[model samples]
Target: MIPNVLTIAGTDPTGGAGIQADLKAFSANGAYGMSVVTAVVAQNTRGVGSIVAMEPEFVAEQIAAVFEDVRVDAVKIGMVANADIADAIRQSLDTYAQCPVVLDPVMVAKSGDHLMQQDDVEAIRERLVPRATLITPNLPEASVLLDRDVEMSSLEEMHASLEELRALGSQWVLLKGGHLGGEESIDILTGHETVELTAPRVDTINDHGTGCTLSAAIAALLPRHGYIDAVRQAKKYLTAALRHADELDVGAGHGPVHHFHALWNNAPLQLQGAQR
Candidate 1:
């Protein structure tokens, strides 16, 4: 059966990140996609220009509506702008606690813009992180969660932080080391056991939606595969998407990964000028 994966996230009009990326990742990974919008963000490959948050009550209502109808096999949570929204999501998710939840802990955009409120970090760490089946946080995000002034810089530090992050309440923790400069990108997963996943880093400028896509991919695969296997497959998927990202021209800044890279045999057809 095709798993029904739900992504509770903000929007990216450019379709490179946020809810758009999540849906694409879900479909790419052979899962039926569903969404609950938490914010409407005006952003592109360049950066986040603005974000308009949804009311906490309405966010709760959307979750309720989905749970009433859909059999969500797994869920990917991203970009809750404030504490109220986090609380709302936590309360709603309390009812349907069976499915695997992958929380990306998206605090800052790839463009260096902050997507969340400074005060909201506490809520995510305290309320949402504990509830997630797995929490994927990069070095910067992990540092923020641990209230550290500096990011983890080495493999030793990453290993240390993985244990610390697992203590933050999630059953599993994936600490991404893509921020570190190296020939290979490494991630540490700790839960039933600790293992390091390493992939040859692809050199690319178009990596806009990597985090969202990865977490979504994991959620899509979790219903069928175990946690460690799902993460390995998701990592492979994201790496391929990144490898093929340069084939498309989407924006001036960081472009989106080619989510359908493995499936598309032909390049996109460009249209000539015509009457609108």
Candidate 2:
């Protein structure tokens, strides 16, 4: 049977971030995607207007419903809206303790909407981070986790953040450097091995779901590849998605990365983006 990947995240009406983007990335990487939404967001390319969080009981029920029959090869988690939701997910995930979990701490949106509460932050750091096989955090989210400001502008800072992130309970940590100013976007991976993956920064305002795309890609690839290879391949996928981001004019504000750009294009760069 084909690998079945699961994403436990919130809803995105814009289809760029959260479960929408997660499913797209999983399918793009050749995985059968499943989702359990923790929230229904009233959002668009412009920004998040409001959110209706799912009840903790329903979240647990959804997870049970999926695991009872389907065999999930990997799991990606995003945007736990509150402490109750976090606890519910953690308890449900405990039943399937052996599965590799990809945790993307979705604290804020591209347009600067706070997706998580302060209490949820503590809950994730204590509950979910320990269970995650891999934790992908951007600079702002990393800062919140470590309780200190994190800047990845310098290679030294990147390495430092990677170490601290691992210490926070993730078996491995991927610190995304897209927010750092540079000619290239660099991501640092630390835990099993320390390596830096860099890609030429795509000049576009339509990178609404880049983070979700990347973490979901890693989750999809982890069933077939080691951490390093999975991260490398995911980086390549994200770069291509970003390169072709302008192809889809989804909204007036920050749009989404083209998740299926590789499947559609099959151009040389689609495979060679991460290496360059």
lDDT of 1 at 167: 86
Top candidate on TM-score is: 1
For candidate 2, what is the TM-score? 0.94
Model 1 steric clash pairs: none
Clashes of each: 0, 0
Q: Which stretches of candidate 1 lie over 4 Å from their true place?
A: 266-276
Judged by whole-model lDDT over C-alpha atoms, candidate 1 comes out at: 0.94
How big is the positional error of residue 80 in model 2, measured in Å on the Cα after superposition? 0.6
**lDDT (CA) per prediction:** 0.94, 0.90
Q: How many angstroms is residue 236 displaced in model 2 relative to the true structure, after the best TM-score fit? A: 0.3
**lDDT of candidate 1 over 1-276, digit per residue (tens):** 889999999999999999999999999999999999999999999999999999999999999998899898999999999999999999999986579999999999999999998899999999999999999999999999999999999999999777778888999999999999799999999999999999999999999989999999999999999999999999999999999999889999999999999788465544586456
